[model samples]
Target: MTRVAVIARILPVLAILVWSLQGVSRAENALTLDLSDYELTFEEDFDRLDVSAWGPGTRWIAHTPWNGDFGDAAFADPRPGFPFTVKDGVLAIEARKDEGGKWASGLLASVDGAGRGFSQRYGYFEMRAKFPKGEGTWPAFWLIGLDRLTHTSEVDVVEHYGHFPGRYTASVHVWDRKTASKSSSVHHRVLVAPGSLYDDYNTFGAKIDADWIIFYFNRQEVWRQSTPEHHKQPMYLLVDLGVGAGWPTENTPDPSVMLVDYVKVWARED
Candidate 1:
């Protein structure tokens, strides 16, 4: 009976070991990629915002100067001919008085056909940033999916205008190809103060699970949306310091600043 007792104990231990190994194997099979271990996936300490590493994904397609543009005019202030500078580890997309006698300094995303590549399905996305505070400066940290070379599905994780202090906006855009227009569904949430985004750095993130996209400000959930049909495609990230669009037009003018510390992506560890 001593031998029988030993066998019973050994069988349970072996069975538990096998079960644990199976669990680990399933986790390994589910992981596609993980950016947490990568140190150089992002460029840092920029003395000047470089566009070389960026691809056909970076270009100026349309601006306030473009007619019939759906973007906000208050935020459309691209300095007519000059470009913004990134120096001393800070990116300053400035608005100054040019010889053209127009106050211009605006932000632009990766052009339709150039710049950063694209991501399709679900992943973890995040950005650390401090926005500018003047009456009309609008800043945004967001993402858009390049659907076979067209801007069809866009997601705005955070969009803040100077006029709306202590609050950030989130939205999703669905393009109507036939009508040449886009349908936007959006939500606005107030951020915690003292920790307000305008004065200091804060981290914003979104975890796009299989069927749910949850928005977080400074790591706290502020909003969530469920759309299983569209959450499976990869999407690229975008960070822009826009001036006077959306809700910034309602306030006064002051030289605002948008400071981005870093953007990071991550995945679940098995």
Candidate 2:
């Protein structure tokens, strides 16, 4: 009986030691970034379609070479064909081909004469959306800085085309004026679940801190870039659906929809 008791006590000690070792192993391999510690600094209430909420640095402009209303304002076309609409509390940016044999639709950015509308220096930006799918359709949710503010710091958080179904691309472009050469800039690609984006709404986000930038798809880390040089500035958010771009080859024939659920921004609550 005494031996039995000794064995039981030693067994517990051995089990605890094993648990401790497992915890250390996980801590070494696990990569974590918790944004819950931050507070909401800005948000857009799409209830009434207010462009003023976007602030002074943004100017709403139609996509170049194509004249179509892109904002959620009264100036937008009342009957803009299929797939693009503001119904059920969502902004649907659809890509459709007109009678002119060209994909005529969507929005772009224009802050001022120099094209410096909405932009920031450094923070956490995110959007919840579902991309459109079809051969020749190009959909994107990303950000571009003003020429005066960033010089050439374009952060593409999520850009994908139906032609390349199921694979999303993310890149960071720093112009030659900003960096010694274009090749010196950092870029990375991530493989997303096949048909996951257009299947439903997923959260696409990017965290730009003082040292590194991390990209996330549906709360999962996909890519990271360690560019301490360009991490100190803020950037704005842009969500649009484009078509006939060089990547998609302009082969899509039917109208497709890019639905955006919401956009939210956060910063460390100091």
Which runs in model 1 stand beyond 4 Å of their true positions?
A: 1-48, 52-83, 101-103, 106-120, 148-151, 179-184, 246-254, 268-270
Per-residue lDDT over 50-147 for candidate 2, one digit per residue giving the tens place of the 0 to 100 score: 33222334344433212223211112232444334666777776666557655554544334334445556667788888887677666676665544
The per-prediction CA RMSD against the true structure, in angstroms, equals 18.3, 17.5
Candidate 2 lDDT (Cα, 0 to 1): 0.55
Instruction: Please provide the root mean square deviation of candidate 1 (C-alpha atoms, Å).
Output: 18.3
How close is every model to the real structure, measured as TM-score? 0.66, 0.71
- lDDT against the true structure, per candidate, is 0.51, 0.55
* Candidate 1 lDDT by residue in tens digits, 1-270: 001122234333211111111111111112233346433333334454434222343333223111222223223423333335555676655544346544444444433343334343566677887777676666776666655333345567777656667566666554433333232344445445622676678877777767777767666666667643444576666666655453435353544457777666665553
After TM-score superposition, the amount by which residue 66's alpha carbon in candidate 2 deviates from its true location, in angstroms, is 16
Q: In candidate 2, what residue range of length 10 has the lowest lDDT sum? A: 17-26
Off by over 4 Å in 2: 1-33, 51-84, 108-118, 147-150, 177-185, 228-231, 248-250
**Model 1, CA-based lDDT:** 0.51
